[model samples]
Target: MKRHFNTTGPVIPEQHYCVDPMTRLDWEDVQYLIGAGKFFVLHAPRQTGKTSTLLTMMDVLNQSDEYQCLYINVEPAQAARDDVSAGMLTIVNNLVEGAAIRLKETRLRDWRETIWRNSGPHGAFSALLSRWAQESDKPIVLMIDEVDALVGDTLISLLRQLREGYIGRPGIPFPHSVILCGVRDVRDYRIHTKHHEIITGGSAFNVKAASLRMVGFNRAEIETLYAQHTAETGQAFEPMVFDALWEDTHGQPWLINAIGHELTWKDKTARDRSTPITLERYRAARERLIYSRSTHLAQLADKLREPRVHRIMAALLTGDENLSGIPVDDLEYVNDLGLVEIRPQIRISNRIYQEIIPRELTWVEQSSITHQQAWYLTPQRHIDMPKLLSAFQQFFRENAEAWIERFDYKEAGPQLLLQAFLQRIINGGGRINREYGLGRKRTDLFIEWPVDEEKGFYGDVQRVVLELKILRKSLETTLLEGVEQTAGYADQCGADEAYLIIFDRRLNVDWDDKIWQRQEQWQTRSIGAWGM
Candidate 1:
């Protein structure tokens, strides 16, 4: 069977082109932790190969005589919610099934019923592990995936049970090591109990030795994974595709595989295995993936509705540097969700996310926009950017008050509205790239429109840059800074035209006072400036 990219589940080595899951982490550290009989947490963002890594580790350990490892997902118990009995029953049953399937051990299934009857929900899980460990010749390692998916008292009970087992360790008949895998570290779990009490996972599972995060693939790993396809099919990817892929995905595993699958399997032309994939093909695939709103991307968009996610995302969207109001935990939470990176600076994780965030936020507005693409095109087939901006100004004046109030992220209303308007006009014929972050104080929008319809992006292309800013300082200072910033971005993009749009959101200001437009020159560039 031909190996292909695996996007949906844990990678099967013989069936998928993959990077070795073992190399994604520090195997040495993992071995040390396991050997020391210490319980640890392994976590990363969703679909980032946490389950795959755990399964691979289980296989490697089971192959040796040193340890008997079993990997099971506890997500099914999430449906039980606060019902500890139901949740624990589901988890225990899953363990029995996993042992039979993966370890070829039927002992768990034989012993689980009596153990649950005697020990009950609170102690059954720990009792089951203790029994399994006692019977096995090798020290057992239990890897529990999606540990955070359990809710309320159900989650609390599981953690407490794990903590109870940790007390026995190697001296007693308990698993030698326990690994809890989830989208967030155990320390970040804010579990709510039935009595309206809050129990932090750290407090419940205080026996945890360490938390190890699994990061996404680096450049070399990406290349190695992609090269597997080239070797098998004889279809090569152009060198430029790698650069674009990196920018679009930042080595995200699902994204890399998704794009690869789209290019190789979905597009029948590229399936010939002789037509080398090019930069244009990669871009088209990316747009399709984004527009498809796949489960992964949809989950990411759904997170924006969360209070913690909303706080950080709103700050990033409006370029608000006063993040003092947002808690550190909120930032870490969003980071763990894979929505934003909280390192050198807080920004959207990658270009694809950056595009999705704004687009998803304004999807409703963009859909309602009834403007025609041809209306904003010049007779020569180029985008009439000036006319487009003028139309937006009129629209904003008429509807900004009503539409802006409708957004959950009201602070970013102007910026999102402008993006929706642009996206509506450029739906098929062009693309817009956005740049905004914590301290940017400005949002940069780059429009790429292919002047020739036949050639698309390969032919004569018109590039336009729009810099969006909220009036934070004196009018003169804001205008001066806006012109320089807009000019700088245009220069970087080598754009044919540039515009500076300042949204004056003061309630006291009238439409006559707030709306204006002018042309300005900075250095060697001419920039159009607008006030709103």
Candidate 2:
């Protein structure tokens, strides 16, 4: 059977299309740390190949006969919540099961029963691990996946057990190296329990030598993945397709794989392999993935409702830089959840995520809009932007206060509501590509509508650029700046027409003053400007 891109679970090298998992990590450093018996961390956003990487490393280590390696997922313990005894019991059971399956070790079964019988709840975890380690002539390497998934006393108990085991290593027959894997660094965990006890993972797991974050695949890695499919089938991707995929996904492992899967298996025409995959096909695959609400994207979209997630995302959409009151750990938490990237300036993790956030934020409002895509289409099936913007201006005038209140991201209320309206119009036959971020003070939109109404992303397509900005200064100043910015963005997208929507956020602003549209020229380019 032909190997395919995997997004559901851990990738098996021979069974699924995969890249070298160690390529995303400092493999040599990790090996050295483990060899030296230093407990450490392996963390990344979910579905970024963390589990696959650990399993691969386990195989490599066990094959070398230098150490016995086991990967156990402790996420089941999360169901026990604050019940330390129940949580530890579940975790211990999982480890014994994992060892039996992975290591073919029957001793773990006997050890589990013996440890629990002799030691009781708190002592069971360390005792079983110590027994398992001593059972092997080669020192054992313990990999606990989703170590931070549990919270409250459950999380504290797990961490403390690992730390105790780490401290007693070499002499007391504990695992030589213990690697905890999860989405966030253990230090970032501020676990709350039913008893109202707030504990930090750092204080509990203080023996951690280092925390290594696994990130999305880089540009070259993404290319290599795509290249594999092309090589196997004698089909080639258009040169620009690679750049487009990279631009949209930024090499997010799941997103990258999802695009490949959708294009190959889901897209009928693209599966033939004789027809080369073009940029149009790539963009179409992206849209299908976005609207399908695949498990990965849905998981990310779900994070928007979290308070910590809301705090950063709320500021992000509206360019609210006054985020001093937001906790640093909150920001880190959002980053860990893979909603946004922390380095190279804070922004949504990818283009699809940027689009999904607003769509999700104003989904109710979008659903409430009675207008349909056909209502905004011209005779040529082109988007009637002037009419759409005019309608939005009226909607803003009437429903701004009521609709904005519904949003956690109220500062970007106008932008979100407008997108909600536009999304309704674009949902049928076109796609909206969005670009917005912290400190951008602007949201850029590119609407791609098939002009001839052909059934694919190709054929004569109409592209329009819309720039949304908030009026922080005088209207005259903001208008001029917006005109230039809109023109620049239009030029970037190669869009024929551009519009600037400036939202007046001032108190006591009159309806007449806030609602208007005019045509202006910026550096020989004409830009339609709207005040809202």
Candidate 3:
């Protein structure tokens, strides 16, 4: 079978176009750590090739005569929740089965039952590892995947067991080196016992020597992966598509592969290979991927409900810089989930995520909206900005209270509602690109509508810039600042039209006082200013 981009699971070299998993890690460092019998962590966000890397490492290590290696996923034990016995049994069974399948090692299978019966839930895992190390002719290297998936006391028991085995190391009957892998660093694990005490993973597994993080593919790696498809089938991606892909996915492995799969397979016309995938087609595929609500994207959206996620996301949406109140651990936790970037100023991780966040938040509201796209279109089929804004102002006045109350992200309700309303009107006809981040103090929205239907975005595109802000200062001061900001953004985007929307969230303000509009001139550009 011809190789294709893979998104479903660990990449199989013969069946998929893939970058070498080892290239994404510090191979030399990993080897030294294992050789020195260091217990360490290997963590990354979901679907970024953590399992694939671990599996590849296991194969590489086993191929060498140095050590016997096994990789096991303990995620199934999550079902046991606080049940330490059940969780341990499930995890040990996975280890035994994995050893048999991957290494043709049946020693674990033979000894697991007796060990569990004699040692009980807490001690069985530790005892089993000790026996495996003692029995093996060579040193044993174990890789545990989804280590954080186990919950409560079960997770605590597992960590303590690993720590117990670590104490023996080379001197006693224990694995030479063990790797615990998960979406977050082991230090972030806050396992709760049945007694309601939160035992952190750091405390439970203090024997850990180091923590290593796996990052997304870099530019050259992404290019190489895509180039594989071109080499195999002679299908070409336009140069500009690569630039857009990088911006859209930020080199996230699954997203890069997902888009590649979408372009080559999902869109039938592109399968011909002779038809080069252009930037426009790539954009369309991105749209489909987002709107399809694929399992991967849905899983990310599910994290929005978490309190830590909610707090950071709410701040990002509203452009609030008051993140001082949020704990550093909470920020780190959110960052570890791959929701946002932390170093070069905190923001959504990528353009695709930036787009997904608003759409997911306003999906229900957008669906419930009864307004027709044609109702706001001009005679030439262009979006009537003035009329749309007027209608939204009235809609906001009527439904703001009830609708805003229903949002989990109530801090960003007004802006989210506005996006929802705009999304309803522009559903199929245009695209809205959003830009917001911590300390931005405003959200910049750019709408791209194709006036010429036959040529689509290739001809006569309507570009409009909408700057959204909350009333943080006097009306006069806000209008002046907003007009300047709107003008600057319009210049950057080369938008033909510009609008500044000020949302007065003060509860003391009356509807009549808050609802208004006016025209402002900024450096020869006429900008529409609205109050709500």
Candidate 4:
């Protein structure tokens, strides 16, 4: 009954099972925060399990006997932003409430008295920490989640208050340690937006001794998670399933858990045998998980639309190697959000994200005639190249205006959308191998469909190699370039047939005269015209 994969948010505490996917991280990372008597910051993108990690760490610290750890979300402070005093008041109250809930102390008389002694909110926070330190036998540790939810003056006041109280370590009667958790690093926080100036938050919130980033699940962790499912459910994950999962997800925790959860919990109809999940099943599960674009993915993609996220993603999607010249401010912003890892030439953080970004950003196909509906069209089992192209030609004519308008990054041209159009239909049953990026010269897409010949089924396969290019001033140069470029991909893929799709955004040609024509007798390729 346990799902073999999960492609969503952090695995739920116990109702939904999980594994410690990240071995590189340990309590030791947070241990330093506790020992230093300093403020600490833990940041990563939303749904990467910041809350889980914080709760788990709280458990770890509380068991040590020497420390009393209390974790709370300062989200209530968000709406009180108009009045800094009110926001601060809400935050302190939430902290007290959170502490009381865990400690089961209805009233910490001394803590309450000290918290309200000061003239301002910052003074109140200091006094409260001071009193708590004096009353409690164990050193106090505070964890605040969703710290970023407090914005503008509210955020500034919170950071300033914490910074002002930073000196209360061993000698001073303040909380021994504190942790601020959010979607950004303390150093990257632009709490104020006056005059378009970035006042580095680190300067104001300099108390952060260290900032720890939580990475997604790795290969071994993914395997262990599935193994846990196998151990509980009696059904196993096939060896190929592991390989496919690794290749597809590359250890994204949300994706790993979500894929398994869908296959196990959501798609009951797909489950028949008590045996391991096969590679085909895994692929099917992956497609379904992606198509659903469930909450987990929605949260992840929400960041993609931010300016910082957009810049980094655009560069990655376009393969702009010139990203070396990208401003440090933007990179820091994006890196803090976990859009792309810093090392290894600044690639997308992981494979799951890589796959999701294109599909998430691409045009959505809506029709009663779904790709699955078209599945029957290939009943003879061979992909009808002519028919597929003709269908797309008609589809493009009818929908290009509307669909092209939906595209956000038109600078890369409409070729990407064209591939995405054909991709939605083929992705489930087949695979669309995409090779595009900056300085790559051209984008290439290869669509491969498998045929089953054993059920007296004929082995009819479709191999399509599509080359996309942008049209400039003259059609002559673009077409000549496309011919040379497409010829290579066709030969490389050994495509049974190839088509060159030139997106004429400029609309130099007459729309009524648009034609799909074949080119080069020797190369055995066809060229299509879809223009304004």
Q: What C-alpha lDDT values do all the predictions have? A: 0.91, 0.86, 0.92, 0.68
Ranking by lDDT: 3, 1, 2, 4
Q: Can you tell me which runs of candidate 4 are displaced by over 4 Å?
A: 1-14, 21-26, 81-83, 105-114, 117-122, 167-172, 192-199, 269-273, 364-406, 423-433, 448-461, 471-495, 504-516, 520-532
Weakest lDDT window of 10 consecutive positions for candidate 4: 364-373
Candidate 1 residue pairs in backbone clash: none
Tens digits of per-residue lDDT, candidate 4, 177-266, equal 889999888877766643445566788788778888877677777787777777777777778887878766656666777788766767
lDDT-wise, the better of 2 and 4 is 2
lDDT of 3 by residue, 440-479 (tens): 8899999999998899888899999999999999999999
For model 2, residues 125-149, the per-residue Cα lDDT tens digits are: 8989888777788888999999878
Residue-level lDDT tens digits of model 1 in 169-273:
657689999999999989889999999999989899999899998888898888889999999888899999998889888878999999988888888888888
Better of 3 and 4 by lDDT: 3
Least accurate stretch of 10 residues (summed lDDT) in model 1? 164-173
Question: 92 in model 1: Cα distance from truth in Å?
Answer: 0.7
User: Evaluated with lDDT, which candidate comes out highest?
Assistant: 3
Model 2 CA deviation exceeding 4 Å by range: 325-327, 455-457
The alpha-carbon lDDT assigned to residue 111 of candidate 1 equals: 94
Each candidate's number of clashing pairs is 0, 0, 0, 16
Model 3: number of clashes? Answer: 0
